[model samples]
Target: MTKNITTTDFSAVKAADKAQSYLFDNFCELLTRVFMALEEEEWATQAAWDIAFGPSVSDADAAWRLVAFQAETVTAVQPLSVDDLLLHRMAGLMSRAVSATGIDALETVRSRAMHCIAQAPMATAAAVRDMAKEALSTIDQMLEHALVCDGDDMSVRALPLAA
Candidate 1:
């Protein structure tokens, strides 16, 4: 279960300060979890490792408390693969969208993800296509939360941004 701040002070200013502190801590924990999950991915890089372990959690393995990641031990280097690149890029764009990507950029990503999903059953591997579809679906959920679009020309307006 999640634990919240405990306080006895009832002053308005003190309560606001406590609330801000709680929110900041919650935000950091969420952000840290995101990076740690990235560090567990098949395409995880040095950057991901640094981001995940560079904070208070200095030593991260495949397991953290009850959370465990399936070990991916493929060290063999293979030839270049565009599908891998495209899939990772799309995942990165979807998962690490911390700020408003603006309506236009989000639309472009949606279009690209859709095209990748629509390619013939012969094009990219089914796994890549499936992951792309999942990422696009997640982005659509995010758009539903933050953007309102006109059905006519797909024009969008931000909803005062999410906090």
Candidate 2:
């Protein structure tokens, strides 16, 4: 015999799907902001400095900040001798910041964006676009999985009562 579903079950599933969609939308916005920030070399360099070391706290801090900020930003994804000390360090610092924020989805997108930036001498507009597209696609897949789970729950709730 075929089983039947109910409306209550469907409603629950719909609610869960909505929640997942909301999360994905927020994640996408964060990715967009990061992409815009990296579009210009000056902005990217400033971000790198901020990530590496927080705002200067003292007189000595200002000198260190100047040195680090003056260092060249690595454009290539692969490491160069100079990159090993600077860009790689910046990547690690930014990754740590993302992790500390406890937003796994945003962190993942940031990591991917950083990877693309690290590969080239300064991130190109095309590469940024590609990374943004990929990040948005991944968010969609995550939302789909949440929606499927919601649908399954709805089916369970819709079952007929035994008499």
Candidate 3:
């Protein structure tokens, strides 16, 4: 099992000053918890939101606000990491979960993630480390598939194939 993720630095570094892969890893970690909550059925009911985020401050409305604050943190990074599809998907799911009136949207996102996990290479023995490794490798593969305007822009191109 992974250590407490709340201890990890969740800061949003500037795009040019940070590595994309690093940001991707952090996003993966956060979503992993959200998906686990869903997969375990803790997020299947209305009361689960407060429990997933934290205890309520006096009332349920306070709990919802706290959850919204956490969701905002994830959504704020979308524009900064615009190139990553998975990141956007996770962020959107999180945003919906926080604002959603019913559990249907959350369940749909959970189902989608479960489907991906079922098809993943490590589906049989899918440890967190294995999933993290796969996430990193996927980023590398995305690099290989990136579109480049020209070979002159070295920043975006993958390794050239041998002649």
Candidate that scores best on TM-score: 1
Summarize candidate 3's per-residue lDDT along 49-119 as a digit string, tens digits: 43455433224343334434544564555434233434545445545544543334444545554454444
* Over 4 Å off, model 1: 1-79, 95-98, 119-123, 148-163
Model 3 worst lDDT run, 10 consecutive residues: 154-163
The residue-by-residue lDDT of candidate 1 on 1-163, one tens digit each, is 9999897756966765565444333323433443454344213333454355543342332322112111111111121244444454554454333234466665665676677566524556565565556556655754553453324232222321221
RMSD of each: 22.2, 23.8, 20.8
Ranking by lDDT: 1, 3, 2
Cα misplacement distance, residue 16 of candidate 1 (Å): 52
Who is ahead in lDDT, 1 or 3? Answer: 1
Worst 10-residue lDDT window, candidate 2? 154-163
* Pairs clashing within candidate 3: none
TM-score of each: 0.37, 0.27, 0.36
**Per-residue error (Å), model 3, residue 114:** 3.5
lDDT digits (tens) for residues 1-163 of candidate 2: 9988764558866766564444334333444433332233224233554345543322223332332232212212333233232334443333333223233443454565455445544433453344434544433333333334246532221110000
Score residue 153 of candidate 1 by CA lDDT.
Answer: 31
